[model samples]
Target: MGEAKELSQEEIEKIKEEIERLKKEIQYHDWRYYVLADPVISDAEYDKLVLRLRELEEKYPFLRTPDSPTQRVGGKIEGGFPTFPHSIPMLSLDNAFSEEELVEFEKRLKRFLGDENLEIEYSVEPKVDGVSIELIYEGGVLKRALTRGDGYVGEDVTPNVRTIKSIPLRLLGDDIPFLLEIRGEIFMRREDFEILNRELLKAGQKPFANPRNAAAGSLKQIDPSETAKRKLDAVFYASGLIKGVEIKNQKELLQKIFSWGFKVVPDWKIVKGIQEVIEHARYIYGRRKDYPFESDGVVVKVNDFRLREILGEKAKSPRWAIAYKFPAEEVTTRVLWVEFQVGRTGTVTPVAILEPVRISGVLVSRATLHNFDEIRRKDIRIGDWVWVKRSGDVIPEIVKSIPERREGFEIEIEEPRNCPSCGSELYKPQDEVALRCPNMSCPAQIIERIKHFVSRNAFDIEGLGEAIITQLVTKGIVKDISDIFFLRKIDLLKFWGIGDKLASKIIDNISKSKEIPLDKFIFALGIRHVGESVAKILAKRFRTLDEFLTANPKEIETIYGLGPAVAQSVEKFLRDEKNIASIKRMLQAGVKVLDYHEESEQRKKGALSGKTFVFTGTLKSMTREEAKKLVIENGGKVLDTITSHVNFLVVGDLGDRGTTSKLEKAKKLGIKLITEEEFLSMIKGS
Candidate 1:
């Protein structure tokens, strides 16, 4: 390697040719090592070729381009993520459920092309259930990794993406484009996901719902180091932004990416017609468990790129590609009866007691009706044969009821007007649809509240499961949350299931729960609209229980992120004589809520302080209370009413009336309108 200097024409040409040859050789080895997982050359041999290329690029600075293999040395740290516009709009695929639908899709493609006699080859592959990403390469090096944010614009997650070993740092081929954006799915392997979830559980963290959830959560982590630990894998499926070359068909595109050392989806095949496509889809669906990753269905596409162009695309999806989603794992059962159950927050939800049926390898004797409104909407009735499906093969839910098979004995359900457990009058809150048991002392509500109080994220009292809570409430050993602390070993030993060992364990857990943080104590109280995040904000704002109880509604309202409804709820709860008495009893029973006074003083210097925020509508990623807590945690303020002092008006799925008033007010005040995604990004960075 030599420094850049004026060189003879012959030397320059020779060096350029060598650089190209080295790039080609490195790319071939990369393909063999990465995509094929069969390295033709030894690791030392591969390193030599990369070293030579780097030397040539270093000596001839002008020869160094974005696509140069030398540029793949990716370790750049980003401060804040910026939005990157996709070179080509990343369109989603339409779905087909059955073989008949698949045939119809072929017909639609033929109809659009206006060539009935045309034979269209189909390329079918398993549709990976993971986070969609667009990885951009320049010259030969990886440049940017982006999320499929709304198709057009996406957040740059280059730093996190760089940590994935499966994703190549640079394109291997000598013909690497000036700019290429390869679209792929980033996922966690099933085994790795299980390991991660097990570790999370052991560490007292909530485990991920599924592999897809774990992958998405890992990818979106603000800390790249955390993502790096997840061992994510990716497979390229399509091209988003391409330059300097053209691909002829889906098969060709897949092969080209594979050749460039990009891992393409496995088990893909090019078939002659719709029948073959259907057969391939069936095979993949049946053998889905054999794969290392999770896939919901298989994707079928018109093989020829020319035909795809002629068929074109719809507003939301491509006409050429259709995802054949597997039928939901479902079973048929009869609803014995519908029971209304009260939650810790007093919301009464309807649960259906079903004739025992096996669904997705699990016995589902009970399913949630969600609420009375859903029961009515679905027209569910007692003794009716209903279709039940386990969502994500986890929670069993009634999908629909069969009217034709309904017997005359089937009964139409009447919504409960009173709490079933305590016969208390139930009331529907304003702007809410669900009927609630407002009485805090209701037996059902008391059981649920006590269960919630001891559950994880609150006091986290282990050994106090729903069964234990039921036993405690039924025997009158625990009439309220505070009663748990007062339970004696003799009293517990009297219960049918309680042995000496189990009783000691339960008593120990209850004793340990007494020394909880103020935030956890506040959350354990089960205040309406005050979730874990809101509890944290309240704990940070008020140093002691006395301060929190003494704070007026107006004073609470002034704190940033406290919405009008939440402020009112807090005030009303505090003013309740029974609620106050429960707190006093808990305190007297040796409950010690640790004050975070020092922590609150430290939080005053947080990045968000002094800035007022007003949020309108429902946030999808988090609750309004959670969003407000983030703002408060960062030292920002939350306002119930949008005013001129408000710096930002965070908007989500706004109601018509709420949107109109807030939008007009914000416009008048010249406040910035922030989308929920933007606000979330801001919080992550903060």
Candidate 2:
């Protein structure tokens, strides 16, 4: 060991002051970057200062610690927020992204409250940027804190919450209330957040976007001390589990909370009229920077908690309160051009390329315009200045256009008179917004049709996507849909990435797809107005694809959702000379596209005999197309989503959101969930 050199007291104190200043400075930069989405210094410059602190800490082993800037982002949260179902569902707040929207929300509330002569006010609290928690107090002692999982059940996080300083160790009042659950956010202080992110950047890791995400990632920690080191603070702003409580209104509740030694958000108001409410909301919006913790937006609730019960809630959100979410980001961008893109099924959709601009936090260079009709309706034009916005920091959209600044030379574009891809005639039927090319021989249409035919909803071929399809098309390897069946292993690797195994799987899949049941064959053909439901009906109504093809416009027009226009389109499509030739070539190509009903009828007349089944959730057991196949093969029918017509509803691990509704409706209408075990046991060979 080396002899220690004694320093003057002033020098020692100065060194200590420098260490504190550096930490504080790093913390402020973190807030500026993560919380505000605005950084003052270059990333390279930020790293140098952080490196100095870390080096000093290393030399002064006593100063070396996990709580310091080094170990924040080392771990990840465990699988899924475990369910600890709250007595009340943690309903999401309705967003108001702008001040105008906030005013409108206030207007409607005041108007409604006026009817009852009970003017309502709200407690404008800090909408903390962290994971929500339900802190349970047993006899004025901190007993438990659970995460808000799915509005009911949440993961047990008692150990993590114990580390936060703001969370009270003991209850304030000795009035001896029974078990009480106070809900609030758990977040890292601004300073701690900066150090964490700075260390992350130095390690060549992607820094977190905000303190909210950091706080959330930290508190859900599997290790308690790690969460404690995050310097997480809590504000018990709301109530969840409560016993022996007498609460009249929100204001009194907040005041009682503050008096009982709790940290209440400052400057809460009970503004009644719409104007005052709007003004108050604006005040908060402007003062968001002044607050210590991160707040994405403000929450406004009807002050009279009684009126809250009266207002009730919608199926999705509450009626009494709404959150006013300020615009995440917005910018003016020039529209470079709008082009039509045709999907595999010949749906002509519009895509817009914008002059590069930043919207929200991401770069905005392109956006989907949806359809030609939507473009015309929005009056979007090239060379026009348009306002684009992003919600929740992603997905750019052209919100509005500035027509006043438009030049007189603005050209009015008409939907293409012909198919851009095939150079054939395009047709738009009556009452339909989309214009489609009826040409089956069109190369673009052929690839799209063939791709959809092999999609998860249709033939269930997995290996063939754009890369392979492009290679096949470009190499003159596959021209029409039927050409795919003839592809050899060597032909697949003619491009890059494909091997003998992949080529064989694709070919095997192609061969398997040929033996498709009648319903799949019908849908794979991409007929007009024939969605899965309509196709199922058509499949049952007409036993074969050829028979349906043979039916005239007058006979086909009678089908549900298929009118005279669709009937004409279908009839016209079948009669096309080129399409007829393609059908002949497909038949000769040895595609087993003809209905299997003929073979089934030859054996047992009622292929779909006595069983009815419904499918729910995403299936890992089989593709939805394959499940439908199982139903058809065993003399059964498949229904869309869930309906009364379905006899057995097949359920999977799609989580408990919309599944319960389907189950409830099924119970009301008398449908049941079929287990794979029970199904296999009951069906035997089926």
Candidate 3:
């Protein structure tokens, strides 16, 4: 070990100057190689500068400081992960799923800047599909590495992050900030991920699901050695909690960080104007397959720090930056089988069970065929290779079958003649495409009904998932949705995975679910054609289940918006003895379905009351589910399509010049076309 010897003034000054000069040279080379993707010097030349700095620091120990380039090596390993509060929150970016959405993002930025014709410069970079982490460097020395746990608070994994070669151990120059927290993504390259997975498989371990998952798992490992073995890399994207840094824009920040011996994200371009932003995003999106690592989208940020500050952020994401995601990745996989799923409404949907394939970072084993008609239309068959798409990055859908790839032995998918659950005759209604199971007491129907009851849009039971619902039904713990509330702790504990804590939580959720609003409860009943909107309408009209159950079809038909199909479905559900018995059981279980009729009155007079909204295209601020919920919660009605009754059309970014029937109808009906932002404003005002 080098001694902490007292050095002569001349010797100390010479060593310090040499160290600073070497640090600057090395940093400049790093910037050239890593950031600009251009290097003037060879690898040996760069190493020599670092070696010289090390030699000088060794000869004159007093000349060394934390800010020296040599100090970039990781600090002492800790026994346990400690919590670290982020000096600045690592907020997520708002997403733009389509070109129109990206355009809308630019429009919003200009609007926020109070200039319709403002020439806004943007920095566009790949939105890496990886784990987000923050690196804190004090006096240029690596201080801590933190996982973005909740944005505000993070788990310290300094020991593990030290293993990443791309992240610098210390700042490059003495001119660097006293304290700098860099936000970056820790990712595994595609080739590296594949190699690691293969090694894991050879070692008789389960292969990683995807590169992102692999990166996350590697970073969280308790053993630093394990993380090192995984060969994780990082790219610094933005600055957080920086002291003594006067960076003015994203471009400057990128260059500055790169000059500090830190790796900057690749393919990032500084573009002028909104059109360039969109063009760059689209170009990057199209070249996704060519990249070395996984990237789902392109992130576009305002180049100016002032613009970013002015634009500010939302509760969850930054308003200044938008992630323009590519259309969900489509890959070909074989259909192993086609199964019929009996819904709570007894509508049998055709689900294509596929050979497990990875699609857009997800393990997709099943895709929806919608119905038997769709299967026929697409000519999907067992043993046929089909193009399975992760639609919108959420749903797995069979886009089309590769009929050319189909073998002669491929079997055509046959429509089920009888219900798969109860073996009852399946019937298809004249107006509908789905085959229905008439037996209300069918096991599949019961299971599905229970699932529907606990779904997000219905009772919203926190702990009662579909798998748990199936287990409860199969184990005879629950026979109907009402049985969920009446389950004993002992009964739930009998299930394999239902531990004491989980069982207690399930009980609590069931107890909480009893106080659900009238509309949600009505929708939870598994009644055909009685979706959330119809349920809301019925709840508003009748006020209570007792009132609704007593009303005849003709009486229900008198209500505005209550069509013949919906009225018939409601009347039929109420008249059924089995359904009535189930309702009675639910009542006996102490279910207190809250009345929303009075609230409906208050809502009608409220801000958005009397307003009917129709949503078109893709919304950026929220999901379609969230949007519908917002409308309903704000005392407004949501319609599927634009019509004369639709007071406002909440239009989203419908990419390109595609014609929308809803837009046409809205214009024809003189309905106001409002943007998603405008709709959000209306909701907030209400």
Ranking by lDDT: 3, 1, 2
Candidate number of the best TM-score: 3
Off by over 4 Å in 2: 1-80, 94-116, 125-131, 141-149, 152-163, 169-176, 186-201, 207-236, 259-263, 292-297, 325-329, 333-386, 391-394, 400-686
**lDDT tens string, model 3, 431-456?**
46789999877889999888888887
lDDT of all the models against the reference? Answer: 0.79, 0.65, 0.79
Candidate 2 lDDT tens digits, 391-441: 553346777778988987665556777777777777776645678777666
lDDT of 3: 0.79
Per-residue lDDT tens digits for candidate 1, residues 361-430, read 2357889887766777778899999999863333578888899998699999888888888888889987
Residue 609's lDDT within candidate 1 is 60
Query: Candidate 2 deviates by what RMSD?
Result: 15.4
The C-alpha local distance difference test score for the whole of candidate 1 amounts to: 0.79
